[model samples]
Target: MGELAVRIEGLTHRYPEQNADQRALDAVDIRVRAGIITGLAGPDGAGKTTLMRIMAGLLKPTMGEVEVVGLAPIRDANALHLKVGYMPQKFGLYEDLTVMENLVLYADLRGVVGRERTDQFERLLDFTDLHRFTGRLAGKLSGGMKQKLGLACTLVGKPELLLLDEPGVGVDPISRRDLWGMVQSLAEGGMAVVWATAYLDEAERCDSLCLMSDGHVIFSGEPAEQIERMRGRCVHVRDISGNRRHFLRRALGSAQVVDGVIQGDNVRLVLKEGVERLDRALLAKEPDATVEPVEPRLEDAFIDLVGGGPDGRSVLAETTPEVRIGEGVDRKAVISARELTRRFGDFTATDQVSFDVREGEIFGLLGPNGAGKSTTFRMMCGLLRPTSGDAHVMGIDLKRSAGRARQKLGYMAQKFSLYSNLSVEQNLKFFSGIYGLKGQAQDRKIAQMAESFDLGRYARVTAGELPLGFKQRLALACALMHEPPLLFLDEPTSGVDPVTRREFWMHINALVDKGVTVMVTTHFMDEAEYCDRIGLIYRGRMIAAGPPDELKKQAADADTPDPTFEEAFIELIHRDDEARRKTEAAA
Candidate 1:
């Protein structure tokens, strides 16, 4: 329209292995206004990243044209680069360098110097709240702090156009809030930003959005309108048993009735038809069903847009039961932790944390940045030996029998741990061997994983060459190669699209049914619903633990009748702040 900050017409990009006709971005056309936050929302392999890269001048389209700030990214590469700040899913920070050193290096490389440098650095550090950590190495900082530093480095020169590719993935709620505040301020200052994210709620916060799917733009407009279009039809129902849940989900899918998702004992459904029809149908089919109308959310819009498979139960139909068969600590209690603690010098990362994980349960360890959730997880998985206390996996002590504990546990870190230089098949082989999964057992497991995750299509492709979604899936497959009774996932879905996340969790849920115990950490609060039990950490302490609804009740304030998890979380943090302030005043 009037001097668009970003304009794209018929843009297309295909990977080297992809057929020439198969485009990652198929004839996509869009325009982003100045001083606005435009979200590129979609599942993994949806081409949001590709589209952003093209607009940022980091990539060239196979067809069509893109212009940022009225200049072509390719032909006007230098000008576009100067006006744009591009941050990939990964920070690309030097782990050995201090936060200040990294910032200074980035600033100097961007030609910022002299008197302006000091002011710029101070302003950035203050905004990120990383001034105190300036002397700490980038690698040593917590996940949220490192992400803030990355954002600070990108904003060093205040480029007119900012392309953030999943920048807030794995970030804590407080850090996420802070980052969004910064984004709002930048947009108000007339800097157009294109933020690609898998978090639907985050996407809902944008001024506008472009929903990409299968390498094509499915919808583009304000998120409010998009959400409103699917209103008054969503409902939630709670249930148990994998077979029954699967049956219900399939039934819901077959009816073309509405969008549905399984959240441990609860399934959220959106009626494609009217609510009356959905009610009538459900009542007729399962008269005993405990169904109630719940407030709709962005996830409803996501399910409505993405949907199940061609037959309706495409994703849900592939459910596999959690596998928890093993001898030790009553197979039902797959993971047990009692007063776990880890200390690094003067810092106590985990402070007497205690929790028990049932076999076949999706247990989530959640907290804000610096809350000690990761440290606790590492100890449980035997990655880090706790300074004191205990952690047992399938009845084996993590500290005393780290090797045996590891054998029964599948672990996936924040980053993809597979070899980048090797092909997908090679990575699988390497991990299989490490787990001692030899001959027929390994081959059978690999084949099943390949088919389910669509790894066969990219078996020959180098792990490094795969897209972010594929990389995540491969990492997951590798982790599960051992078919362990327990799983520890640290923000496994941090940077993937909604569909990819859903798909990945679909597979995980299947494993849960087969008795696999999962303990995962995630920044996406909504994902907490999937866990059978949840532990909320704050300032190195376990503040809340139980079912999501129970914790929500516990975290709720006297003023709110029924607070959502996000609201409860905010309330808890505010209370913590108040208590800290009171302690300081007394001191």
Candidate 2:
């Protein structure tokens, strides 16, 4: 460690209307060293954002001391601003400005000029891989591209300390890797980095990890140490019994099972301490069910430490319906894209993309930033007219009868698109009305949704005032108010905690079980396992499409019999990139 970059002691914060128990942050002590990355990991409402805001001088702590770069945050906020770079969860980049223009404006605002400014611009553009899209409007860029641009703007002056709040929340894995690489390089050059994230895997990369819960730091130290603490306590149960969900539900109810999650075809469980023996008698009831001790992951340890018993069970409104695959090539398609293509001037957003989503299927569109997934989604949802080609939803032509097609489908945009000024209940009512719900029907639907999504507490709260997790739930509720048979979810779980994500998926599974067809786009590779089929889009084309297990096998070789979904996704993208490079070289 070079030097102490940040120091906090007895840090506590509370909102004005909050009750005595509702402190955003409790008495917390933390020290961040220069030239290292400190990760803040926690569930929703854990106060990670609160601490970051206080460090950035955007908010004042009710009690406690905060020192950033040896300057008191409250007393020397103006000076502190000069030596620190803070990127909030939602980075404020002007939508109309081009990528280069945004960088220049931020540089000007930060007083970066001369040769240093020129060098920094080149470095940022290169590091973020945004050099190719310098002239593209910020609004025209994909979600991941916008994140990179935001990061580039924040790096204008190369401040000694960087505070990044969920910087990779909605970013693709490749872009996330690039962003992390850039941050690590910055830290190696003696800058202190504090990263708050919902992704536990990202926390494992940090030099130090701080796990927070209920506004308190329950654990803080090396990530490896945390994992070590849960060693021998984690176990993997192979479900040869053919009823994984039932087994999971039963296991969760048992006192021995701490937490259980579906991982591929098996159930990974964290058992309570001192329950070392596998219950053979219990296994005898379910033929061929076997349990084996396994290495604990960061998520397993976090869940165990936080005592998240049967966490997210409330989101499981009902049992998921069985997904039937390989019916036939002649099966009727719920969503179909035939030679879909869209272009803007010289740039092609999507090109000749053709795919079919079967009825009652959970279809996933996977890709990196700027790979045209959103453009394709918009075309299918009837939000945008494809420059050529055709799209159909529920057998209705999107190009010829978009209105009729839209009526049969529910669509959720990547960002929170509900009315910010309206209360949660009001927003739900508005959406219900838009979907043609009336009088008692709309009222009943709204009440049901409020309960289903656990939004009853925030019914009267403004949509903008709710937390990110609640906002996500409200947006989903709004989309589903009319109970459309087909649904489109774009980055639905982005920036949400693991528990919230699990809850969201449970709801999706329940809806799918009721014969609702779903089309979703996401950057999180793990989510692909839940989908019946996934299409990998890259550079304006559909490069690959298959079941998650088949896709993983395609990316694997003899040496790697079972490759992770993430590894498969990256491999496919890389292979496509290499092939494109070869074609360009030949040209």
Model 2 residue 165 lDDT score: 96
RMSD of each: 3.0, 3.1
Give one clash count per candidate, in the order shown.
Answer: 13, 1
Best prediction by TM-score: 2
Worst 10 residues of 1 by lDDT: 308-317
lDDT of 1: 0.79
For model 2, the superposed segments whose C-alpha errors exceed 4 Å read 239-250, 277-286, 289-292, 309-332, 558-561
Candidate 1's error at 105, in angstroms? 2.1
Give the alpha-carbon lDDT of every model.
0.79, 0.85
Question: In model 2, which residue pairs have backbone atoms overlapping below 3 Å?
Answer: 321-513
